[model samples]
Target: MIDLNNIEEVIKEEKKILRNKSKNYKENFFEIKNFIEKEILHIETLKKNGINIIPEINFKDLSPSLIEFKKEVKNRGCVVIRDVFDDNLIHQMNKDLESYIDENNYYEDQKKKSDIDKYFSDLKSGKPQIFGLYWSKTQVNIRQSNELNHVKKWLNKLWVNKHNNQTIFDPNNELVYADRVRRREPGDTTLGLSPHCDAGSVERWIDKGYQSVYENIFADNFIEYNPFNASYRNETQEIESAAVSHVFRTFQGWVALTEQGPGDGTLQLIPIAKSMAFILTRALMDDVDDNDLCGSKPARALSVNSTYHSLLLRGLVSIPKMNPGDTVWWHPDVVHAVEDQHLGKGYSNVVYVGSTPYCDKNLAYAKKQSKKFLEGKSPPDFAAEDYEVNYKNRAEISDLTPLGKKQLTL
Candidate 1:
């Protein structure tokens, strides 16, 4: 947490760096300020809505209301809600998956999909256990159950359209990616999520689109810069990939699957959203040169291959940990990387959720994705060789009912 006091120094250096690189510094610097302001507003809204990563959020056995959960996701731009679904049910699902694997040795997908090292490991040693939640009748039943559906409905409301606020499955629409969950173990540190913005670029001199949802910085003079403008996110399930398509991933989220406390394999965050974005963007730019347009970290003064390399010499970005049943959500543009769960007993399990997005430009991209799926190939938004999975279906939950929104909605 960079102290509000150090912000002045940061801004001073920001200007120096901006001037040193100095391209449209004036227009962009203030926009940087605007971005910070908007993020604060968004974080505040997240707090009021219930889940917060701020120092004040006390996740002590309390569960937030569904409406409040929806609001929290809208305001904070991300959250971790405790017991969004019954923990016991998740426990049962885990047991059933393990049993299914044991009974039939249901490892064909793993075998067929896996390769040399992985196959040798699986056949000789073993592969990581994968429960068929993607296909299991039990997993399907639970994910679609009324209680979970209520959560999904609110997700649809918070993520899609607040005006429609429709908490039921409109056959025409469904919650996106209603089937994404992962049970992270205590010592697993290789899940590989780099701290990068989803929308691709963060050129300050570009469009109105944000690199970080800094409401405090962006919404100057708006008595309130409304964070939950549902119109920007009105869609249900669709899309082949959330990456590359660049739909509004306003909030990145997760639902807790167990009791997580401090030092218990919790989720961590860089509390100051815009400041991190500003410094990181500048850090990358300042570290690069005219030739390295690709901007690889070529032996520079400012390179953080280690996630812990502090960006600011004088100030530290604050991070808050979350507990199981405790959800930790954040703005889409906010940079987040999983903390290594080095000191926990069981596992830190979660269902990752991000806001559903729908827009005309995104829709056209999705139809192309459907074509790729039909051809039994990777979706267009991804590289030809990327994310080639044997998973059965990738149909959009809606179109916005178009292709792009539909694919990513999942």
Candidate 2:
């Protein structure tokens, strides 16, 4: 971890680089400070209103004509696309997952295994709520489903490369990133994920590739900083760090397999993305140099707490109630967390199905993931342990659709 005391010098050094790059950088810095203050109020107001500002749209109704809907997603950096799959399909997937868990004795196996520490730290004082199995049949089917492929295509199109109007990827061609299935039972709060963004953390400032994504912020026109841009994100590679995500997922998503409401251990997010500008410019206001990038050397989750960002901490709101078959997706830069407690009646089941558009780095990850799929091993980005390798019902390459095979580089 970088010393919190050195944060002033660190910001000064980064500011020097920004000053040399843009002529009016200092002027923009002052402007960004004022903008941050206004944003603090705006975000607080939205937070007070709850998740009302977080847009909810039907997947089938998605189009350019929904100008307000598009604007909401662009501004907030997250959305709930209802009915991505049918209720029956959602119920079936849940059943399939339960079957797999029962057959493999997942709870028993997990309790016996000592190396299941990739995702969580301390399991809360009860039964495990999340399963790490990535290649389950239902997961594979959803990843390779034609309906989901279309949905991903639509999701990718939501982003536009505003820089030089240059297209950097094929939004229509889907790419797959296998992730875990979360099954949060009522009153279960084992996952200790705090308010944080998962993508690059401090790399947003250190890594030149990652820093390019925030060039507008450094230039002092942060209000125009479009998160949808495909500038440096296409090339940003992961450095040696803890909690690294290799794939540049445009949006992190989940397909709900069970009905869940706000208090049901569901997803929580701070809807505004422009507020991120404050994260960098905060040193100008605070006494502590806005220290603790919260995403320093040994990269960890980019955390948001009352000490550093009280507005954001208070602004974090739970997404609206959702039913099975609903899909919720958040921008890569959004600060999100799982509710610490589940005060609902039943389990909150969902599969992580993020979007990975076609890009050189992402394509490379897909190719590697394909190889891991063939070997019945965990993907390179995850822990190397392969508990599913000997499982009889694991999904294989043959089960993938034609497009799915293509996405996996098979």
Candidate 3:
């Protein structure tokens, strides 16, 4: 439904804007290049010493008093919070999911599978591992859990509104984005999603509202840019599509249902604030052709790696080992990817949950998501598939916790 001609004109205009700012961009490129050279050495040294750069913390220990901890989280753009849910809760939750799958004969049901199977069909077993069925009793319980909701609120607090002291949303209040669960079997590499930032793709430079997030880099004031600043994020809208993000997530996070470690189907993130500035500026260097907005487009996943971002690819590292109760979160703009293979011995499962502060745009999406939940359908931002409609033992309205009811407007 998108007009390709209009997109081409917008791309041309964006190219012109960058061309006009070429002088400053060229000047800044060398500084970024030098910085990257040093950073690569530092990252390599850390990797050699087996020290992971991703910050890790215990949920109960989180406090404003931990200034250094908070700063590292903001600087790295990703964090792992241990013990977000108690050991008992996580174990029970995992069992619940397993039982649900078995009870529903999920493994035998072709309709319950994800497209990830086709991408890595060679590695996938006869069993369908990654599940698309949302609203499962276990998933609903986890989404509505008090511990999980509290974690979402805390994650939202990391963002500092930097626009004239005008508050548009309350970080204390959060919205629940309906997402899927990834239950990968051992040695499965079906999730081959390469290094890419989520939320906005071409919209990052095309939509005025979304473009504000990176305005500093575009204007050659890269150093002043703060990824944590929640400016114009709520107002930014994405063209309704399966690939476009429906809401702005300050931190895209997940609840681990199984233990995972490096080389064990863990997440990989480019953990540096400066890398973002570098990516934007590098995209505008005079060498870049006018036909491409740094190879970005609506609904297409933007890749950042050795091809377009060499420094970042070298610096990418997996987080420390995670247990069942642990949770990991990363800034929405953080470049992340899944490990290409899972060498582990068991299934690595996780539920997608993120920190979405209550805003006009987010609330509207949540309202629609709530309606979809009741109708046994996918959320607005997702494809309107009716995969879970007739499933047995699915979560119902009564299963919602007090906080969940408030978030879903039940």
Candidate 4:
């Protein structure tokens, strides 16, 4: 068994194991460097031409067989789907969420606390942008909405779900991976999130399952690294932490409940799908210490910053203006951040909804999450705030639709 307390030793040992497994490691490093340099130049050119990097598709236009649309999504690593939900429903959800929090005295209760959850301790905001409350009726309704489910299945099909003649995940089937809601007030000056990849941090480098997922990159053939392939992802295990998710999400997404644009504390993404290769190979360079994986830590998200990833950072672009009922989705490996300031007049409200297909890992998590949903507690993957357990108007199992029940593995 791995000792969580002695993580430094584990880091050093994993680095050595990877180095030994690699053939012509130095040459491979140089090749990856060259590719990144070229990719940066290409990104710069696109910016010079005033190109909108994040693809936008109307919900009606989405189709599984649209080869060109699929190519664009594959190339950019992120997309914004418009009108995925009804405007009336979305507006009601926003009002319902506010009423739920206000009626339960959530903010008043929070003010008495000395500190926020450790996972979000680094964030700076006048008021909390992310709420710990999970079982709100608005959240449950949104998670089980037909429009969101349809969009999720379409997004999942973009991945190659079979490897070595073995089916790894069922794209047609989705599992509920409950996450939090965000409501950034107008003129909010939150420090906002930094560029990072979720799911796992150092585990991506140290875990055996993750290593297999990126075997081509480790073997000095990063050009063959296909980010869309869902081979060993379901088998990967992250260190147990409040910040780490135990299940694999093909895409991390959010539905915009308010009209949020570039300056409205919206999300920004590094729009290259294959940038994971640059991240993995860059850490193996001689300059970085053997025990370090480029600013990675056990319980934190995988960070991408100017020091270790200036090239990839250059490609960072904010999503275009999104209206209520619109949604944005990005590949799990994509690096994303939030705009530091909310200059817009409206509140930036969104509900986190990830595309978690049916798999052993995801199904197991869904089962646990279902229990939490029933008990009106936080999902197992998050901090145990349990703010909703005693709160009035929390959604119950009877409130769930048939589709929601299935997604929650009920």
* Tens-place lDDT digits, model 2, residues 297-389: 334456665676775566678888999989889888888888888999998889999999887778888988888898877787765656688
lDDT for each residue of candidate 3 in 1-410, tens digit (9 for 90 to 100):
33455887776687677546545667777777777678778878989997878888888887767788888888888889999888887889888888877787766664544452232222212223456667887778777788877777777777875477788678888788878788877888665456777676666666778667777767667668788888888878676556457797888888899998888876888887567667766776767676565666666555575657777788888878899989998888888878878899988889887777788888888998898899887677665555667777788898888888887878
Question: Worst 10-residue stretch by lDDT in candidate 1?
Answer: 116-125
**Poorly placed runs, candidate 4 (over 4 Å):** 112-116, 120-128
Clashes per model (N, Cα, C within 3 A)? 46, 0, 0, 0
Residue 183 in model 3: lDDT: 84
For model 3, what is the C-alpha lDDT against the true structure? 0.75
Indicate the worst ten consecutive residues by lDDT in candidate 3: 118-127
TM-score of 2: 0.88
Q: Candidate 3 or 4, higher TM-score?
A: 4
Query: Candidate 1: where are CA atoms >4 Å away?
Result: 1-76, 99-174, 178-180, 192-194, 199-246, 261-266, 273-326, 357-410
What candidate 3 gets wrong by more than 4 Å, as runs, is: 21-23, 105-129
Model 2: residues with Cα > 4 Å off, grouped in runs: 1-30, 33-51, 112-129, 162-166, 241-243, 283-297
lDDT by residue for model 1 over 1-410, one digit each (tens)?
22233433443443354344434444444555466666656655665675535432333333335455445445434444445555576666556545543454435544544442121121211333322233332334443444443443344454333445642223223333323345656765544233333333322212223212322233232223344443423232212332233344445666555555555545545455334434434433334442221222211111222333234211222234444444555665454544444366776655554443334444444455445544444445333432223443322233122432333333
Candidate with top TM-score is 4
